[model samples]
Target: MLDQQITRSIRKMIEAREERVRNGDANGYGVDFFGMLLQSPVNSNISLQDIVDECKTFYFAGHVSSSALLTWTVVLLAMHPEWQERARKEVIQVLGSDTPSFDGLAQLKIVR
Candidate 1:
């Protein structure tokens, strides 16, 4: 029952996002992730289902890595609150008012 509800919700979310992408509402984000994927030269011949299947693969792969990193971070933070504050301070000092982003991440030598 819960699985069906989750599936339906995800279907609706994807449909809404697809509608937004088709209508060019994705321009708000500057570089639309999904729009770029769908229009990519390498993916041009692939069907929508192929795109979806590839997405599922990436989602599951990322989920594991992200969850593990988050779990370990939380555990370490709980064990060392002092270190947590220092890490947060360093991150803020390096990022310095700019939002955390992929482009910004590349510039953070201390972080990378």
Candidate 2:
């Protein structure tokens, strides 16, 4: 029941994003996942169920795992201020006032 509700909600979000992308609203860092999927050749013939499944996959793997990772990283950082400072300095050096791009993030070895 709850899963169905979540799926429907996600489907609505995907439809809205698709419309927004068609209207040229997808710009800057506000890129929409569904919009990208709808446009991608890899997702040809994708149905609403597919989008829901993708969102669910993101919830299970990406969202949940990232949350747990962030929690642990915060705890570890609190225990080690020196490492935290080192991480901050490296971020500034690597990013250097530029918005974080996929390529830039990939180049940040310390982030891994």
Best candidate per lDDT, number? Answer: 2
For candidate 2, which ten residues in a row score worst on lDDT?
A: 28-37
TM-score, predicted candidate 1 vs. hidden true structure = 0.47
Model 1 lDDT tens row, 1-95: 95456556555655777677679977532344444445443435766555565555556677898789889988988899897777777778777
TM-scores across all candidates? 0.47, 0.57
How does residue 43 of candidate 1 score in lDDT?
32
Tens digit of per-residue lDDT, candidate 2, span 1-112: 9988988888787678767756888652143454455544343676667767877888777987889899999999999999888888888999999866545666787666
Off by over 4 Å in 1: 1-27, 30-57, 109-112
Check candidate 2 and list the clashing pairs: none
